[model samples]
Target: MLPRNTVDTTVLPPGERFGMWLDLVARTSAPLRVESAHAADFAARADFTDLGAIQLVEYRYPSLDATRTRKLIRQSDPELYVLALTTSGIGTSSQDGRRSEILAGEFTFYDASRPHDVCHHANEPGRTRATSIITLIPHAALPLPPKRMAALYGGRMSGSEGLGALLAQFLIQVTGHPEQYHAVDAGRLGTVGLDLATTLLGRNLVAEDAVPTEVRRRALVTQVQAYVHRHLGDVTLAPRTVADAHHISLRTLHRLFEAENTTVAAYIRDLRLARCRRDLADPALRAQPVQVIAARWGFGDKAHFSRAFRAAYGMSPQACRDGAAVTARDVNDLASRVNSARAD
Candidate 1:
């Protein structure tokens, strides 16, 4: 992510600022009629990031009116869903004959493919700028029904609580702290973003079942994986137990795992083995016996644990731990090494 542009109307001959703003907006977003005083005393800036499947843009600007007219719709209709999250501003919007009043800490959606009107005004004049996060989501990327969502356009939605709050929190974190995530994980983040958005819309409409099965499945898989990792020390963490915890049937849980090319039991075993591998290498746990280590990771039977550990690491747990003894954090300082690799 990088700063796309910074336009301070104050430096310009007042008259040229509004025209330049129009051109800039026309190139980045849809063409709209911008209404402001002739003084052109406004100032604005924007930053954009290309997050695979979605475009995230942060805008800081003064109060203005943006109107999308029929003529502009005829000029071009970019079928995109724009979500405007107001961070510090008071705004009003109208679409589909519905009007909504919004304040700071709120969000609303508008269809870029149709006509709409927006009025963004500042709450206090001395603020840095009326900032907002605008997410451009393609029509095909959203899993919820479009018409159903359209009915919600131009309505004030709470982003301060519930699922919408989670979505809002995630957006703020990802955009504000990009270093916390890996670049390779951008696509996954996008998927989660869409799922949260769909779930939020479904909840707002009081029709969660309308959310697509794929959307729900992906979301459930994410939640279940976290739950499993958190409770991996429990020997009773079996497929039936996991299914019950999630309020889903055992068959459905198994099917969800299968979609990821594994079974519920296998996923648990792999994670357990991973934890065991990490523990066996810990210098503080060197005095601990292999049986104790195995039990710590939920492997109850001694013989079964030994055989499974050998099958997974090509060596018994004891042998692996003996070879894993190290005094330093890096491999360059390691006294011995053992290849403990497994595919899941």
Candidate 2:
């Protein structure tokens, strides 16, 4: 799991919330001049998770003015563009002389390398506080000219619809389960994020062609992979079924998989085999039988599944289930049968 930096104002005395938060944020993200409504009313908490190139910070706090100054930029390392998603709060931000009020389910992109100010206050004094998630994206991820890209900054993108909704869902997954993803997964996630953001901004700029072709292809391929992974337990998940579900032809689906150095059938089979191998190693699954595990991953024929398993893993299913060691995060088929059998 991804480690996080968490700060709760309730831990310290009410008077220390302002200073302590400043210190914590300075270490977790870009250094800034922070001002709360008043010294005594400052009550807040923040959780920050650093994902490879991106950072996800969740906050619930009273109104405050957070200023990104030139001096802070010179002092900080690896400056970024902060994309703020306000989920349950009201916020107004200003950058490059642009200002906008962000409501619930809205996002604002502000450059940490430039002078900017985010002023948020509880509309009802001590009765309310703005809550938001800040995703820090690198400048390199966005591939548009400054003037063109400036339109996305300090404005609200409806997080409730279209590509914005998809991106919001992705952000939630990354922040909610960072540990479930690996290094390569992180890079893929980051790439998809850039592609989606670029696509969103490009549409608004009336320059859809500005997005990189490879990036778009990767995004589509990632979507296909996710579909296949989610339906792995379905014995009917074939290439044709996949293509039809995606509204693409079988040939096109094969073409997409070709770029990944594998075919659609091979990909699904490999994933299932890996899962079976993992379950074979699970001591908790020791009482399970071999044939059940094979079928669980959509292997219809016991002999066929055994031969395939041995060819890929150099062992029979029974041997693997006996004492072999394997590493896998996902399992299917036989494990389901095992559970069913135990329940019966």
Candidate 3:
């Protein structure tokens, strides 16, 4: 197993910090060159080996000028493509006549060989917490036109929705549980990586229709489901809005859902009910009125919410909430009994 590698520049001078960064880059590939206005005070860690086709790295740094950062990237690895998820701080990058500002909770991709700049500003001095998962993959592996990738290079892609959400969650999980993964899992993750990259590229290019029929169909359904779940609070949300978001006809949207043995309306209701069920079981909301919780999850009529809840769980809404409390206590008691038995 590969042990995690971590480095904190706060403990080292500028020269030593740059030297450590160089050593890290060299460990994976050729030697890297470094340059900066004032040397970077940064920290980074890697938890996996480079034996896999792709490598993941987590890095953080304070605010810096765009020109200097681009220069460093170019000198370090001119042929690699870098996809960065900015967790904090604000930054902007420009390429191919397109310029975009990346704020927290967004992602941007760039190529090291291209001359691009990124400027970062912290909300407060010495308080920047920019967590990025940088994936290094060969240019040929992308399987998309260079122009299409460049079009998306500096733009903010939504990481909290659909495939982006799945991708972000996977990266976060692996960052914490790198040891649980093996070489086979890494290869599978690479396939997912390509799917995500392709999806993002298709969105940027306005050429989703150009993707293979099955892949496009699956991606569209995923995007539609995400949209529905996000807008459940809006009473106006319906099949029309879902179709409008993806620029498809309502009839076609229904056809897509039919493939999964569902209609859009049924799917939305099921999702809303699931959300309400979760809220009813939450201990923190025990004091809140059940009607308020129902409305919060898009159930406008209290009577209707109760009927639906009972139909789904075979118990009234209030009874279901009470049952959750009993279940929690029973689980606690069972755990105690198991511990006592183990001790005996």
Residue 74 of candidate 1: its Cα lDDT?
83
Q: What is the lDDT of residue 67 in candidate 1?
A: 94
**lDDT for each candidate structure:** 0.79, 0.77, 0.68
Reference-based TM-score, model 3: 0.64
List model 3 lDDT by residue over 1-344, tens digit each. Answer: 22346666656765576556556655653233333344555443334434254566766665445442444544565476766666667768666567888776677877766666676655645674445666666676655666656667667777777566755665666666767877457666665555565666566678775455655666567668757877997766788988988789999999899888989988988888888889989989999999988888788888888899888889988998999999999999999999999999
Candidate 1 achieves a global lDDT of 0.79
- Candidate 2, residues 174-212, lDDT tens digits: the string is 776777876557655666776666666666667767767
User: Which digits, one per residue and each the tens of the lDDT, describe model 1 over residues 23-52?
Assistant: 777876567888864325666766676677
| Every model's TM-score | 0.64, 0.70, 0.64
Candidate 1 global TM-score: 0.64
Candidate 2: residue 116 lDDT (0-100): 87
Where does candidate 1 stray beyond 4 Å? Answer: 1-19, 37-39, 124-126, 221-344
Total clashes for model 3? 1
